[model samples]
Target chain A: MTVATFEASAPFHIPRWLAPFVVLSFAYIAVPFIGTNYLFEAILLPFLALSLAGVGLNILTGYAGQVSLGSAAFLAVGAFAAYNFNLRIEGLPLIGSIILSGFVAAAIGIVFGLPSLRLKGFYLAVSTLAAQFFVQWALTKFSWFSNDSASGVIDAPSLSIAGIAFNGAVGRYIFSLTIVSLLTFFAYRLVSSQTGRNFIAVRDNETAARIIGVPVLKTKLIAFAISSFIIGVAGVLWAFTYLRTVEPAGFNLDRSFQILFIIILGGLASIRGAFFGAALLVVSPLILSRLGSFLFGDLFNSGVLDMSQRIVLGALIILFLILEPDGLVSLWDRIRKRSVARLNKRKHVGRAAQPTQ
Target chain B: MSGFDWQFFVEVLIGGLLSGVMYSLVAIGFVLIYKTSGVLNFAQGAMLLFAALTFVSLVERGVPFALALIITFAVMVVIGIAIERVVLRPLTNRSPMTLFMATLGLSYILEGAAQLIWGTQVHGLDLGIDDVPFEVGGVLISQFDLFAAAIAAALVLFLSVFFRYTRVGLAFRAVADDQFAALAVGLRLPRIWATVWAVAGLVALVAGLLWGARLGVQFSLSLVVLKALPVLVLGGFDSIPGAIVGGLLIGATEKLAEVYIGEYFGGGTESWFAYVVALAFLLIRPSGIFGQKLVERV
Candidate 1:
């Protein structure tokens, strides 16, 4: 290979310029704790919960190459299961019940995942759609799933760990942050292990992976099991820490598509991309609605805003897919690389100008 | 002890079948697009809503009903051509997954655009067709139902003939089978795509007009149009006959479940019963009733 080829393939290194910005980001996240109740509860907590879900989905569709459209169904299952467990199993700790619900979700996820062995792509997608319909049906049919609540909604009691009650916004934010950080760390480690490599292999080519003794079916089932467990935990957190009272209608097909959009716009197959994608999905709508109201005032009410939002969102997705299929993460990477190259060029010019020095 | 009326059952059955025919009309739009483009137009249902809304709004403005319909149909056809030229052709080399996502986005875009242009409020649409119920042997059927069924059948027959014997139809089939081969033989792919989308638009117009007459023209039209999805799933994406058969089966079963088994679960099974049927079908016959058996090299 030529010298240029070797240089091009070299491992990407972060530039010094971005280091301070990365440090400041952590500081910004910490600022929320010092903020008032409204900001913490209404915004940051829910946003974090959504970010966790996005990351959970990133594990399945992004890393394992499974295109699931029934993610919201699993989220619903987790929420309801946790609610039931918390109510029925007397004196059970909240964390324990939530963890137990994850197992239930993983089991259901694996059963639904069995179809993946015989089908894939669009076929698999439709199969998952079945899961969405079935779960919603079961929820509506079996009133016990919603605890026979009059409105088909479930309310979870405040979570307490060893008598440290997380009852409000501040308690909830810390709880969410702690859980998200732990899960993210585990996800990072999981993605770096042998199991992760197998997942990538199976995703890249299942049949080839099978031929090469990668245990394709088992690896895929494992991916589904693990991914569902994470998603289930995220769901439990969402219902308990965020919404507080959950219903079947709240976790509908639109929610599923919204998650799918997050992953695609975040950058498929990248962990950090989930966070970025979630932030965009959450933030852009807020910004757009504000702008819409400012421009049109009362003329563009919620109904009109909703319609325009749908149109703009659709157009943006198509535009992004055509122009930047790799998504926002790749765009960030490209910008960073360009800046680094420019800096290097300046350094080289200065050295040449120094002559014998 | 038990006094069950057989005539009521017959009435519901006939009503269900007529609705099935209407669903088949919507499914046909999907079939034509899928067959020609190999992309499941998730927005097919939205197109129906848009066309019906446009037709109703035009007529409500004092335009002649017939003139409004023709004009609305032409507008839908133009939208079809625009979709092919602007959105689809650029996505030629992308994966089917990408195409699916694109169509989902397109569906959202169309629904939003429909709401924007036509307003979200519901509108009454009178098609100048018969609305009285027909009675025979103690059973009753709506005259509008018969009209819808007859119109759907006529449209399907016309489409079959168009695809089978026409020059453009031949070009469509040729392009569907292999794009590269069609190009080698000197077929203008863009032109073919445009024509196929236009035909799909016409099919959408017929379905929208009938369905809107039944349910009234409104934003909720998109929700009802989603029934086409389960139909497409069970019929196979690219199979026209499959769509007809699938739509009929879903219609019959969903109605039967709602009438008979709905009480067992406190009712409302009608909302998702067809999806359950399709899901079971997917488990049994994943390729669907008439879908081409997929051959994977790997």
Candidate 2:
């Protein structure tokens, strides 16, 4: 469909209820600058980086339908590559370094992704795990990646846009927000394009997609490349602006699995679900811990129950997958429709039920 | 020192075979579970650790080693039955991907629960058997390794007999081959599934004991089963014999790599050497040595 026709035919224009929500979210995202230094450093920046990583993964697993269990390895590639570029290039622009890191990550992702051409389903998962071990091993063993640091850790160089340093919490937060927002806008556009449709089509049915002229191999590889590139950039920001110093263990299987859980919890196919899922994975545990403390005082403390937290979380993931495979985004959609129906019911009586059907 | 030391080669080969037997024990548990449920039980390693911990603790608390081993096997049977009833039964007819995720979750739960029940500290397990290395024709070998290898061979032999000769075993293979067809012919699907899980648990208990005896019982003991994964990939997911052969191949190569190739890389190559073996096999024959090639009906 032409862009003009698509705009004209679109149903359910942005509702009044959602319009306020959008504006409020934007303000909340911007208003975090007023918080204390610890809150920004300890909370918001890491959360943003993790959420961006979640979005990058959702594009691959959720949209492209390739299950990746080694996303952390890609993130590590980005962070370490960006570090090397910044150190070696001498007068290299920061933006150029960040973009180059993504390209490096994409190259590594493709190398690991080659097995996917022959493997599928659970077999593919096991294969991806090799990437996790191999990359982590390299990071730990090859001291050059960490610049021969004593502890095998890399420290992010200070960020500068043409020598205007973003050194403080406020400056870093603004820089991260602008980059994440821009990347998110581009992701949204990409997901709606022909390439995106082809990915979803292949995901839904590879055979059917191939029959209909979708280049299966090219589409899958492109999805992997794009996904890794975005995740790599996020990793660069994660290290440079968020963590400041990173060890190999920080980007292991746990982070990859956590990101998978987030995307799955949010909604598989929806782009906006990335934030919802990231919020759950990142913030829900903290919220749950606080709630647990309030309810149980000192007896059933969060730390003691931390191990149990995994059991419960595992249970919840299975429960959500079984009961509501469409995830929290679908639940949100359902609630909005119901409320709209309830209001119309008072005005039109019996007509509301039919419209819902 | 000498041209082609015959005794050293024999010694390394024997050692490799012994370690391979232990790996096969774990892979066999994996094969049994995969055959019946069509789910790769990632928790097999964790189950091994849990079983080993339970066995050692019971023995440490004054139960005889023999009694502890038997009691642990029985407990495994019960645990297997519970898993089939509580976890697998509820999610019957879900997609394979969902089942895979559920198993992954189960692994986390099992690992955590094992740690909580048995403190995270490593404990030395004494099997009441001599571990001293003995020599035959100038080739020194540990009796513990030989005994473990013997036990593995005997277990596989018994399973082979049980599956091929017994009525219950026949039911298992029938169910594995075609669940719907077996059901159509008046077979009880749930009963067969329960039985298969019980057998898997029994194998896990034995595997756990031997592994713990060698490595010492700890939470990380579960990672050794990861060594079995490459075995599964190389042997094909469903082949029992493949598990045995794959295990041996991995065991020999891992040791050789650590001793030979690891010198160039400053050692620690054993941590991931087996995966490299599995990856190479996957690149060559993705279906595995004994696994049936998947023909997707497009």
Query: What interface RMSD does each of the candidate structures achieve?
Result: 2.7, 2.8
Please give, for residues B1-298, the per-residue lDDT of candidate 1 as tens digits: 3898788888888888878888888988888887777777878888888899898889889899789978998998899889988788888878777777888888889999998988999888778887999799889988998998889889989988987899988898898788899999999988898888888888888888888988898877776656777877788878889989988888888887889888997887876678778767877887789887762311
On DockQ, the candidate that comes out on top is 1
* lDDT per residue (tens digit) for residues B1-298 in model 2: 5587777777887787779888889999999988877878877887898899898888878998789878888888887888788778877887666677777667767776777676677889887889999999899998999899899999999999999999998888888788899899999877777788788888888898899989999977888767788788778788899999988898888777776578898777766777778878888887888887872211
Q: For model 2, how does the per-residue alpha-carbon lDDT over A17-114 read when each residue is reduced to its tens digit? A: 46435844764665664588976787778877877887788888888888888899888999999999999998889899999999999998888788
RMSD of each: 3.9, 3.4
Residues forming the 10-long window of minimal summed lDDT in candidate 1 chain B: B289-298
Error of 1 at A262 (Å): 0.4
